[model samples]
Target: MRKHWKSSAVSIAIATSLTLAGCSSGSGTNDKENVSSAAPSSQSSGGVSESGFPIVPEPIKLKMFTRIAPVNGPFKDMPVFQDYEKMTNIHVDFIEAPTDGFAEKKNLLFASNELPDAIYRSGLSPLEATRYGASGQLIPLEDLIEQYAPNLKALMEQYPEIRAGITTPEGHIYAIPGIVTLAAARTDKKWINKAWLDKLNLKVPETTDELYETLVAFRDQDPNDNGQKDELPMTARAGLSVVTMMSGSFGLDQQLGYNINIDNDQVQIWMGDERNKEMLMYLNKLYKEKLLDPELFSHKEADFLAKQGSGKTGFFFDQTNNNFLPIQDQYVGIAPPAGPHGDRLQAQTAPIARDFGAFAITDVNKYPEATMRWIDYFYSDEGSTLLRFGREGEHYVLKDGIPYYTDEYSTAENQPKITPYAGGGAPHIISDQVASYINPPQVQEAQKQLDPYMPKVKYGAPMFDEETAQRVNVLRNDMDKYYEEQSTKFIAGALGFDKWDEFQSTLKKMGLEELQQIYQEAYDKTK
Candidate 1:
């Protein structure tokens, strides 16, 4: 889900081969020297115990397939892993692939019976995890967690919903989940061009009416000082929907593109909702008045940036810190606009509570216990932080009771920023007992912003059942195609509310009813 985009063919081939070979061989110790030499420590690196004991030894070599690009560059080795090997006596042989090709390469590897000792940052769906685990290609992690992962177990106890989210109905955990603590900051925020607001002498809009009035002023008053009515009141790129932040304002659940929650328990096609009709009607008004970007539906990322950089857009929605902050200096994150129904809701999606990046033991692994123990260390606070942030003093520093990035790691320096410490690369790993290890000030501020609207944060029911998951996946793809086409048509003024009924009928014909039922059944099961 992190938007890392890059690809290369050679890396893909190497990664594919490594994965296939790992899966095909039932013993992990076949390449003992390669695994042992990779470790940082001498303690129990790879071989069996001298006692010839039945119990597996501590510390082992693990082969991992991951999408996390090494900090120095592509194919560069990770120092943190080296340190981990030394400290825990576990060496991990990593098969790194570019994020763009990770999913495809992983799929190929799975099909070829070449699996690594573990997978980190895998793109497996819940259904895939279930299928693989059921077929014994992937081992159940629950017993491992109970026997070896004390740190992870404690965290799960504190937040039990995470267990529910990752657990299969059969009560096995196929993957270790990555936890995201900064829920508030994760919600996309509506951002407005403060420079334009200041020029027009307008305050930040809160309610929909206020927003509309301000946007109108922005359009007519030439806030950009160009002496031309070239301002676009609001806009988003063609594929990215800006309306998700606004939908909650219209008294709809936190639905976007395909997933819609009806009456708090049922999931259905969002575009088929009556409220969607109302939303489309409003969008049509914006289009008719020329307030919306005329090319919004067809605009590429480059085009979107051009519009924003050219000072033509008055408002847009995005992750405030990650997207908007990097570009414009004069912008403020605002609460979702209030709507006619007195709703001012914001959509907050759930973060994977377990390691979204997982480590799976292969049947080929000779020292399974050693591998498990090394991975178990990952669940430990110390190990997690090390993997996520690198050696602390090098990547980050503790200053006056707060953890802050060093000058070398600061974004302001234009230095090669470390990925693990930065958002989207890896979850922050810190000592579980260390209060200072909590999120940074900016993330805390973002969370505070959402506290006022937390009561309105509603979640769609879980859709994890195998059959229901497959149906949902199929419907999701179809709905995405339909929504993209229809939304473009509506935004471009090629479609209108006059065809709204027809749109709903078309959605039903496309299996919306079956999708809804599937979701409903899943929801009931969860309850």
Candidate 2:
């Protein structure tokens, strides 16, 4: 769930044959020596009788295929995994790949039947998880969680919605997800240059009309005081720009590209609704008046940040107010402006969210129970603390029983270098309790903006099945490209409401009905 990209390779007959021969030669144990501090015992179960921690006595090794964040260093050298090895008496032979190259390598490994005991951070989608689970490549975890995963079981019981999200229509959980409950739900925070607003003697806009007037004032009067007329009233990058946040004001849920929602237990595409038409009209007005960024459709994140760095941007849409370094204080996070229909919802992330597929045990694994127990620790308070914060005295210091980064691990420059060395950035489950108490002061303060809108946060419905998934992926991909092209035209005044009916018809022709049907079926099954 950290800052990791996806990676892929095709299956080849030669690779599969070679893998089979290698496996048949011997059990896949590496010649690496025991470097952990745990004392080796003769008992395989280690005769240990604890509810959590130290699952077995004799060291059992597991082969794990995982992806490493660029900041997390090499998997084998991470202190967090090493400490976990000692605590669980389970030495993991991590077969890790770079984030960008993991997806391809994972498929190649699976195609070659060279699957390890389990896979971590495999980046599998819900549909892929279902397909693999049904095909027996990925083992079902309902029974395992019931027996060996006390911490995870307790978590599911506490948050039943999470359990529902992960459980497929066929009634099985094929993967374990990272529980992100802290500030995870608030996705669309609009940050304004407070310094610019103060200089212009303007109040924070409370409605869309007021926002427009403010932006117009920003354009007519140089709020930056540079007398160059260079200040952009608002700026956002190419994909999912400020439009995503503003679209919510039009009674549409446009997050995750689907823009589909379950209303009164019925599936519908919010983007296809009449309200979206009005939204686009308003955006076109802004584009015509040059209130919105001129290069918004082609600019990248770097370009947007560069504008912020040069103090040329007045309004920015983002999750945090800390993007512009050295001048971060000039920005302040604020709630989205209310719409005419009083719509003011922000898109919130699902709690049972997996970063692609963070944890899954394969059919080749011989120690399902032990592996389940090993992973369950991460969901526990003690285990999550160790995984997220690392060894207390060494990596961080405890103040009033709460962990805070020491001087060495506090700054941005050193945090990346020290985090991987201390073993804190690896993939692991962190509970809402951990996130609320452990986050730094700035993060906790920004979370206050969610108190008013958190309950109304919009969440997308669950997706399932490989066939439906594949079809939807194709349709969604084609439709997204079309939407971008059409949106640019409409905002640029090249496409107008005169062709709006034609646009709707074209969407229906592009499989809108089929997409809705697929989502409706999945939604009913989940219910």
The CA lDDT of each predicted structure is 0.56, 0.62
lDDT of 2 by residue, 234-299 (tens): 877675465566776666653222565446667677655787788888888888899988888888
Q: Give all TM-scores, in the order shown.
A: 0.79, 0.82
- Runs in model 1 deviating more than 4 A are 1-59, 68-72, 224-232, 237-240, 255-258, 262-269, 287-290, 293-313, 320-329, 352-361, 367-384, 412-417, 420-446, 455-463
Candidate 2 ranges with C-alpha deviation above 4 Å: 1-50, 184-186, 254-257, 302-311, 352-356, 417-427, 431-433, 436-445, 455-460, 492-494
Best candidate according to lDDT: 2
**Residue 422 Cα positional deviation in candidate 2, in Å, after optimal superposition:** 13
TM-score winner among the candidates?
A: 2
Report clashes for each candidate as comma-separated counts: 26, 9
